[model samples]
Target: MTETILLTGAAGLIGRVVHHMLCERGDRVIAIDRIGGENITACDLTEVHRLYELAATVTAVVHCGAISGPMVARDNPFLIVSSNVVGTANVLELARVRKMRRVVCCSSVSAYGNTPAGLDLVPEDVPLRPTSVYGASKAAGEHLLDGYAFQHGIDGVSIRPAWVYGPGRTTECGIRTMILDAQAGRTTHFPFGCDFYRQYVHVDDVATALVLALDMEKLPRRSYTITGGSYITLAEVAQTVKRVLPQADITMGAGPDPIDDVQARFDISAAERDLGYRPYVTLEDGVCSYADWLAAQR
Candidate 1:
């Protein structure tokens, strides 16, 4: 059956992939973004009236829109709050008014902030202690959705993706930068030390998780941690790059991890059981595929 889907942030990395997947699967996508694109309707999500108008025709909403990135949130806290928190409220209100079937919110694992040592893998039940403003905004968004769901009986699910990377990535991530630099035969140096670790999920897998959540008949869990196969350290990432491209040069600074002490690993059993979410891309294969894509762009 054909469904009209409202896709916010349609031009963003994950949103773009999800839009493509939806279109390919014969679904109608009402793509909206703050920035104008070929087929994307330019509109700010904070405008509640405009969202209500857009939501009336769509059966579901895949909200991938927000002021993302840690640095942006740190520098401009107000924009982060308004765009993430206020904008999310607008989306949920639209859903409530329209009585939409389900809404799949693209959340982040950063919500589980500053985990203590020896507690490596985080789960959905972990308390949301956001260390950064961006994480807090995401946590707030999740809370807002839950509130709406409880009060208005909205069927909403939030998918928390960790360190997403792939083609069309707008922001700067260590792995993406290293892979592109290696493809260009340029030396790459990272400020963070080798101790730094993250659970990196490919953009395609994240998009798939969102679609799965959207298509499911019933959602038992409100939020699921969707990540890569496992957590990997920066040193392991460099090794993978070197293994793929022997001539590539990559180095990391020597010191303790300067970043916040958050759990880099996540137990995604909830996602697997509820949504059949399984990350098929391994680090080696994903890097190689990304490198190939970078080479083609040159």
Candidate 2:
């Protein structure tokens, strides 16, 4: 028998891809997003009553709905807390009340903001030291998942992905901006993040990790990190962009992104061994693909 799953954030970056993959694999998906689209149930994730209403229909929940990242709603910490933290609480409650078989949370790498100054590689076991409100919200959600699993046997897990990027992403992405500038014949200049190095995972790879977490009957670890398989600096990113658009003019300054200071790559061995997760997109290929998508849009 196929699993009937309730997938949130159905219209967002990774969520949309996961929705397509799940349906193509013959799993029934009840796709929901705060923003409504055709075949997507329009509802806020924090609406406890609405979430509960759909609980009976789904045997599992992929809680991808949340304030996407630190860049979003930087001015409104309340939205971040309410939508990410409280919304997570609400989803866990629905799973608890409904006795859902499993719940896989779409988490973030920012939760490891405090992963020791000297050592940068973040593993699942690192203490959550969140630097931003958005990071704090994601950390809180993971804690909630652990609590629910211990207390209610919810089979909850979190897939923490880093610097997620791919087609359909509407957020402020450095790579996307550079590619668009190249396509539009504009110079892309950044005053910072030249020496900064961080991870990037394609949205398709993130979807693969989420699905793996959902299908695994038993997970030895409650959380996993998914990355693009390497940490990339701005110079490396620029090089990849130049390969795609040789005429593109892009430059960066000497500092990192002001807010996102977590200069680290992720250890995916746990995710690899446990979930059979593998990142398929290389930086060059992902950038090329994203550029193709952006060009088509123009």
RMSD of each: 1.7, 1.1
Residue 12's lDDT in candidate 2? 93
Task: Please provide, for model 1 over 102-213, each residue's C-alpha lDDT reduced to its tens digit, 9 standing for 90 to 100.
Answer: 8999998877776555766667887899888899999999999999889899999999998887777747677778877887779998777587777789989999999999
Candidate 1 residue-wise lDDT at 105? 96
TM-score of 2: 0.97
Pairs that collide in candidate 1 are none
Give all candidates' CA lDDT scores: 0.85, 0.89
In candidate 2, what residue range of length 10 has the lowest lDDT sum? 114-123
Candidate 2 lDDT tens digits, 1-298: 5889999999999999999999999999989999968779998987778877866778999989999999999999999999999999998998888889999999998888846667656668878888999999999999999999998898999999989888988799899989999988899999987888878888899999999999998999999989989787887889888998998999899877887855566789999899999899998899888988888888
| TM-score against native, each model | 0.94, 0.97
Off by over 4 Å in 1: 254-261, 296-298
